[model samples]
Target: MIQATELRLGNYVNLNDGSEHDKIRQISGIEHKIVYTLIKGCRFAQVHQSFDRIYPIPLTEEIIIKCGFERSEYNDYRHPILFGTLTLYEGVAELHISDMYSVWVNNLHQLQNLYFALTGEELEVKI
Candidate 1:
């Protein structure tokens, strides 16, 4: 199992668009999977222009492991599939991953462009 601290920021792409402008807020989970939240309103005008509810985006084990998060840690908290949740904060908006697909590619995109952004060598996602 990979340590959470060992996981560094990697290639992140704004799944909403082809832009690379999403700020990762925090990562939390039990073990095998981790939950990644984005700062509200970090996307381009076009992407945020039509925003409505806030929900968590789930990612697959392949993507999470590839990003350097230890999947074995949260085996107990692992959800079968991707799911989203709507959260309201100070009348603003927030997203939370209630399940795994939240990290997939529905609300946000993978940071494939930022892959090399990490200081270490390229790490490939296991299929």
Candidate 2:
């Protein structure tokens, strides 16, 4: 987790549970009174207040696999797979950054988006 002052424009964050990921589209105000930009269609947007916790999504092989990318496809570097935001969360429940494929994400919502896109379900974790 990080502070509102540390938030970047494209940073991914889970303002709620670890399941729902929203991107920081914009930032305004000052210090603790920061406001976030929100557009239509996203799970969240346009916050007049700052959240107590904003969990940034760490892009890693474990996260990629958890989002559902196959490990077998990562063996090659030159012929790697490139996943767009639309198709990234489908197919498998395990993935990670690979030399062969480029996993693209500019915000936190991509994590939830991937999970939902692949599973046709809301992102959630078992307690």
Which one is best on TM-score? 2
lDDT (tens digit, per residue) of candidate 2 on 1-127: 5566555443345454244564433333335555454443555646544565454555444444444444544331110233432223332223333445545554334555554555566544211
Q: Output the number of the lDDT-best candidate.
A: 2
> Candidates' lDDT values, in order?
0.32, 0.43
What is the clash tally of candidate 2?
Answer: 16
TM-score of every candidate relative to the true structure: 0.22, 0.33
Q: Residue 81 of candidate 1: its Cα lDDT?
A: 32
Q: For candidate 1, lDDT tens digit of each residue in 34-90?
A: 433334454422222111111223454444544444433333122223223323223
| Alpha-carbon lDDT of model 1 | 0.32
